[model samples]
Target: MERQADWRQEKAQALARARVVVIKVGSAVLTDAQGLSTPVLESLARQMAALRTAPDGHERRLVLVSSGAVAAGRAVLRAHGHSGETSGLSARQAAAAVGQGQLMRAWDEVFRAYDFPTSQVLLTRDDLRARQRFLNARNTFAELMDWGVLPIVNENDTVSVSELKFGDNDCLASLLVNLIGADLYINLTSAPGVYAANPQEVPDAGILECVEDVAGLDLGRMCGGKTSVGTGGMYSKLQAARRAAQLGVPTLILPGREADVLARAFGGEAVGTWVRPEEHAIPRRKFWLAYQSDPAGTVLVD
Candidate 1:
């Protein structure tokens, strides 16, 4: 029997009508120990294609923020016996050099099968932190969506200093949503959902269905970063959603092991966790201030 997502659910319909959606894919989902996973990307394209076809004027506008360039690049380097590592900055830059093209070409081939045109846009934190570059980048995204092109973004790893590449796609995803003013920010990963207890350790760990307020949850105990070739885990996903909620954008974090997970997430099948914005949603600038502000020296005025 073939598997299918029940798109008849409420969130499924809402997702179809969502004016703009930003989806982030982690390295774990897109790669194996050796490298990039072909089936994963293909499955992702299938889900996006469905939303594109949905009636009700739902013709969705989407942006995919993907991570895996370094993994892919490292794989290529390993084949040449280069060790794919460096003292500090060179290791990451080398991996990115080998992987960015590999990643983009693979995506291009799969996306082309669905006739989905994609554009590669590598970004850096500096792009978002600086007001002028940030505005330009935002305008670029808007223009791309306006023209119906899927913008596949990743950190410009090739040129970035070590340990500073968007760090992980989760943070990149959140910032992307902030930049685009997206209606929804969906993080598609390999894990099921946030569990009440660490499932691997606790045989019957409970799955958290919804998040009304993040502070209420003990997320620190959730999971760690980048289990494999990827550099993100459930922790970043939750943080992304929390930041998105504060900015008045609802977020859904779910497993992307299958193509239908996208539909499943919005369809209300309990595939992942949902975090909603508060009543008095924080303004974008304020949300950034609270969440993205630097942990620097502080002084209080009474």
Candidate 2:
């Protein structure tokens, strides 16, 4: 029990000391059959507001990576006499175009109510692939943080094609961790944490609280696939955690719908799975180049 206590304390300290945090909210947590959950957004905004006023007198910088454009678009489409179950890339793109604005509007209203300013930042994989563009994006984020403006980042789904897409917000969140050198990466999902098996299929499945090495685990089989409304599942979250760990950024995956989830998480409560960073940390510039930068060409040398 002493060892466990030490582990818990260590995680609490890591969370408490995190000056810069990147939070990614999945579509499953943000949306339902009807539409976006105002209650959830309200709670999240409150927590974010609280985070801005740290006890240590140091201002915390936060960046939110939100996914729900497609789901939100579907609701808009349904209201316009279009089927919510619209298929095909073009149809989904159209939905994203309509929903993106609505999604931001909802976020803006919620944050504005709390007296917080938020800026929308839409990005594609291609945007971060080029060296000059990557640096430019990094500078933009720095400026936003310096100005005390919270950036709400999302994939440019409306304009991005299959080849240029980041695939899911999970990957994008991990890249953001490196992009801004965030101290912590929080992945708020529908489920509590990583499970031993599918809880739906196995009634007695257990949650793993601490994952020291995500690469050692068979996450694909353990966590399974994507959600109905979102492209990423538990497996993608684990992948994101591993990527963040590579750069010495710890990641926490927790249930977003829980009452004061963000507050409880930073308050030293062991609420979800914590992926610890590796002992040897990679240089920020090197990590960005290796992971974020797209390779021009591969030359096989003997």
Candidate 3:
């Protein structure tokens, strides 16, 4: 395929082989400044439920890596009169405690509507970075898949120290794509995708159609919309999608607010910027090192 090829031409071919897909939902998409958008979450869940009932649905499995507990939790805390003067760590942990229940309730309501069982799996960075923990996490998801249950994962923010946190689900999304060996990774965000200039800064910023390499891209100039409940911006998402693509897992960076975008992606339509997977899945050790290898410290290449 040409570097700039309209992926639509290959949608059928792509979807045919896409058996496992990972979706990353950022707080911007799942919550308003105050808290969770029950209706939007319901709508998204309905879409996913609809997909599961599709003819080929049984052949495919979908995993959701969601971020919103902190955002939602903060709202709950504020509603309960928690002081805004709390430390960042205190606020996040408090919010997570309050909102995790609400988040699960919303997802449960939707998934149950279709008679699908959704199980929650809270993980810390250690779960992905530690080899033994990694295998255990994978096996649990594998078992869930075997039993026809959709595994819903989120970072264990309530107890995780800062360094232990994946920081944002964008990075978690990328790492999860590798963890699950997903065929496609869909990263749903508030904005559409990567742009040459920050969309807010540049009125005419255009979404790049496909990303072949982000290592050479300028990310310093990119900033997130500063959603009240979340800390990730498109820059983190670009980092996520690029990492997933490098693992030979195709990723789509699409606007979460757009109706039916996730469904369209699964249907093999060009929904947003596409980060095509590397020509092939890199070998295990190299992929593990590059995808999951711990960096002792920052090192810039000459």
Best by TM-score: 2
The TM-score obtained by model 2 is 0.94
Between prediction 1 and prediction 2, the one with superior TM-score is 2
Which pairs of residues have clashing backbones in candidate 2?
none
- For residues 173-206, write the lDDT of model 2, one tens digit per residue: 9999988889999999999888878776777988
Error of 3 at 66 (Å): 0.8
Candidate 3, residue 294: Cα displacement in angstroms equals 4.4
Candidate 3, clashing residue pairs?
Answer: none
**Per-residue alpha-carbon lDDT of candidate 1 for residues 1-302, written as tens digits (9 for 90 to 100):** 32124323434655656778899988888888678888888888888876665556556789999988888887787778887344256777777887999999999988898888899999877777766777899899988888878999998877876434567789889988888888888888877777767665676877777666765667777654456666777777888887777676777778888658877665557678766654456677665555444456889999
TM-score of 1: 0.87
| Location of the lowest summed lDDT over 10 successive residues in candidate 3 | 1-10
Clashes of each: 3, 0, 0
Candidate with the larger lDDT of 1 and 2: 2
TM-score of each prediction:
0.87, 0.94, 0.88
Q: What residue runs in model 3 are displaced by over 4 Å at the alpha carbon?
A: 1-6, 10-12, 53-58, 222-226, 267-269, 291-302
lDDT of 3: 0.77
| Best-fitting candidate, scored by lDDT | 2
